[model samples]
Target: MFINYVKGLLIGSANIIPGVSGGTLALMLGIYHKIVYSSANLIRLKKVKEDTIFLTMLSLGILTSVTILAKIFKSYILDGSTRETYLNMLFIGLTTGIIFKLKQEIKTRNNNNNNSKKITKYFLFLIGFFTTLSLLLLRTYNISLDISEYQNKKSIKYHIVIATSGIIGGCAMILPGISGSLILLSIGTYKEIINIISQLNIIPCTIFGISTIIGTGITILIIEKTINKHFAKFLYLSIGLILGSILQMLFTITKLNVKPTLTLKISSGILFITGIYINRILESTKK
Candidate 1:
């Protein structure tokens, strides 16, 4: 149980940091498979006693770690535009590193009987999820959240946006190559989410928690089966997903009040490369 708590701390912390992968962190901890299987069966009321205990401890650690980190980030880390720019560049580099990791994995899994059946299944997934995807993109072109609007009780549209963010976050939490925090950043809700958690805003947290659970339950089965039966297609899908998310992250930040100073350019170049290198090393490593 103590170890579970520790695992949760690490994984949950990873979940918040841009470019880090909680699922990959879980994989490194050698707990990914069990967590997945247990989560799946737990929903079915199988091993309720054991799984609940395990998940409860893990969840607590995750919650504790994230809350603490959120507070720290809110208080000290993300203070200035220049600092934010540097951090974002590093994150972008790290996130880009996942593409290399995926490149290798996709090539490795390419030997699997590749065919169009898997493509068709994914087509259906796309069709079924068309509306949800639409909701996510609604803010893609303009990624900032206007809290003032929500305060007026006229932020139903933004409310819907946050709710959709929860769903995407939930699904990303379970997937390996893609992480929930990264997706949230791409969708323009990362900082708002951190602030919300730090401030203990009940409404958004509730919406996020509920949607995360729902998204996990809804997508896990489909995702598991797809990976099992169509490994190559899943890799391709993952690549596309990461690519799109990264593009969005960069795009949204461009809309921010960024000043392209010399220091900014140099830091951006160096840190971005450093992030990619660090990510590549970590992603290639195993326990």
Candidate 2:
């Protein structure tokens, strides 16, 4: 239970980062399937006791981490400095470690399959990779969210837009390699929403929260069904997205002109190994 809480914390924190996906972190932590299964089964009331307890703890952890980090990020990391670059480096290491684990899982699962099918799966992997890479690159240029409109009108239209964006962002959150905040950014509501969160605005935030819950519930149901029918292919696609995310991070760092000092490089290397070691420890404990 404590371990699950920590994992939840990491996932929540990852979600706050622009290129990081909470779902991907959950996958890396070996809790993604369980989370999806539990969420999907929530309405059935079967295994109610266990599922409820697990979800409750996980939710608490996520909430705690998000709230704390949101405050910290707003206060310190918003300046777009080397600190943010260093932070991204650490997360990249963590992501790379997870990608390694995911590859091994894919290989083990596909070991029994035929060569042609394996080739096809690899092709699907490439498709997923390119798909995600394109999206990230496009996001760099597009400004979809109209914050001016949001600020000028406090009418039903504003509320509806916020709710709709919340739903979309919530759905994105469940998809591996997709960042919900990025969805909000694409819609141009990311800054406004963050301001609302920072100010603790009640009405708008409440509406957004409700929408997110509804979206997450529906997404969990859909993904659970899909995975039940097509686990390997889905996993391959997920791996591809993960790989794309890693590349995107490297790309962003290069674009930002973050000079990698020797000490920073050494620290990053240690953090990368540590991330792998921690993942292995978590998997072992689960077994």
TM-score of each: 0.68, 0.90
Query: Using lDDT as the measure, which candidate wins?
Result: 2
Clashes of each: 0, 2
Lowest lDDT block of 10, candidate 2: 145-154
Candidate 1: tens digits of C-alpha lDDT, residues 1-287: 89899989988877776545676566546676678767777887899999999988998999898889888866765555666667667766766776676677666756645457657546644543343244346555555455445553236776677788889888888765456876677667787788778988888778877887788777776666676676666655655555554554464456456888898888789999998787656555652
Q: How would you encode candidate 2's per-residue C-alpha lDDT over 149-231 as one tens digit per residue?
A: 65654688889988997898789888887778766766778777777776777888888878987888888888898799877
Instruction: For model 2, state the Cα shift of residue 279 in Å.
Output: 2.6
lDDT of each: 0.69, 0.78
Clashing pairs for model 2 are: 145-187, 145-188
For model 1, the stretches where C-alpha displacement exceeds 4 angstroms are 1-34, 46-54, 75-80, 112-137, 143-168, 175-196, 201-208, 283-287
Candidate 2, lDDT over the whole model: 0.78
